[model samples]
Target: MFGNICTLYYTRRKLIFDFLKPGNQCRQLVPEATVDVQRRQRKMTSPDDESRSFFAQTELDSLKGKKAKLARTGTHSHVFKATMDSRGNAQVAVKLVDLRSRGEYIERFMPRELAIIPRLDHVNIVAAYAIHRTPEYVAIVEEYASGGDLLNYIRTRPERYLQEQEAKPIFRQLMDAIIYLERLHIVHRDIKCENIFLDSNLRVKLGDFGFARELRPGVDSNTHCGSRPYAAIELLSGRTYRGNGVDIWSAGVVLYVILTSYFPFGSSKDEVPAIIKRQRSQSIHFSQRLSGEVRSLILGMLHPDPKKRLYSRRILAHPWLAETPHRT
Candidate 1:
């Protein structure tokens, strides 16, 4: 029985990849968005030219005071909300990474992120306006989401959780973004509520591609990246994992947290061992308030076996996402 299941799982995975491969019908599902993205691409210059023009023409307003610190500091970078003096004071998020910081991230992952972010042009993904690079620092100027990140947005809510109706649209938007990335063979290894942003209209804008990389079909990645709480079982267990499956697992965790305001696995990094054990057992306790379809969807995504996990196309087509939430 186990061997049969393994065979079926591998077959399903291959079918999913075939559906998502470039020039497939999956691209037709997002025709309008794809056209818009292409239009934007036409107006953009080369990354080097854009970067040089941005720095030469625009002056960034300083982020100095205590209140000026816009985002949580990472290992070697500081993020701040700033304005461009040349572009009529347009708001932007500036991520400044200090080159002097000693780490593999500074030398390797940071450059990968810089190179990838510019080529992407999805509406559901945050836009990178410019990238300023120097020996001392690397500054990434990106679109500013006025509504802030999903983590802070949920925490500040009266219920500390979103209703199924409210969460549905958000999840759909995230699915759309993920599907777009998957089509490009880009895997966003770091996907969590904190990395998901909301614009002024509360639309989802996926961001933070620091751990993102391209993973070709039939290839596997061994790097263990992303927040512990959102990491896939294969990643947490120190095994080679398909990048797409890793993303699906994290997206499941994000969905769970959006609806429950709690982690589906262990809460903190310290509980990694417990999380791994729980993942192996395929143990996930869901709230009764979530509909049967929602639970099933999450279960499909958070499956311990990466081979059996739902792919991007499957997640987007799930029945739970097709239902319309009746607005109050």
Candidate 2:
């Protein structure tokens, strides 16, 4: 029976792998044709001249007391760390997305995270201070979290995780962020530890809404967009499924890693057949050191069936949350 199940799992995985391969899939989903046209138009126009004139006229009135300095360069954007913004007189992080170079249609097609961020006002969510758009680039100014992202924090301070009492509050803060996203009908496709930022007080703030998609009242998303290990079985199956459930599954993986410092589904580099077989058969095992409630919560979130998984709101009200109070 076990061997038969393994064979079926391997077959399903191969089908998904074939579907994702370059030439086998339809090109329409890639939007390459649209990008090509936009790229041609961009080359004809004088991008530098347009940017200079636009920046000069804009006058940085909104950024009154702030002094922006280039922080780091991401794959698609340049990050800036600005000192003391006009609104809160607090440090802010700004991301400048170079649309002119990437292609004109790319900016338009790219997710309007600024529009979505302002609509979301939660203690556990990173606040969008201001948005500036020019012909060359689209800039988003947001509150800076001094404590940095969860992944970096974990790497620097592995001892913090050993203190379950301290970690409880942080977990609760993460739950708050997830609950808020669910209420907005937004599913954060990527919910890994790296995406969760921490303020000076160590309060959680969910960042990077690039992969997030809004779900209509009765509609569900089918896009397989997220980190591989965090992806749920339904997503790995290459079938259209509710994105919210996938986010819950990723959160479960994050929770497991935070507690045990290891992944539940092994690693992404593992053999495809072995990974699928293990995931399909629900062959996950937790360390004996994990508490009963924590194990139960992780299992609840990692339910194979989306319908059976715990919703964000319910998770916030769970007994584990009651034991750990999250303060803004």
Q: Quick one: best lDDT, which candidate?
A: 1
Q: Cα lDDT for residue 214, model 1?
A: 85
- Residue 221, candidate 2: how far off, in angstroms? 1.4
Question: Given candidate 2, what's the lDDT at residue 260?
Answer: 70
Cα lDDT tens digits for candidate 1, 173-224: 8888888898989999999999999998988899989999989888888998
lDDT of 1: 0.71
Q: Could you give candidate 2's per-residue lDDT for residues 101-141 as a string of tens digits?
A: 67532553355454466577787887765455555556676
CA deviation > 4 Å runs, candidate 2: 1-62, 65-72, 85-89, 101-109, 158-162, 271-274
What is the model-wide C-alpha lDDT for candidate 2?
0.64
Summing lDDT over every window of 10 consecutive residues in candidate 1, give the lowest-scoring window: 1-10
Clashing pairs in 1: none
What local lDDT score does residue 53 receive in model 1, on the 0 to 100 scale?
Answer: 27
In order of appearance, the predictions have TM-scores of 0.77, 0.75
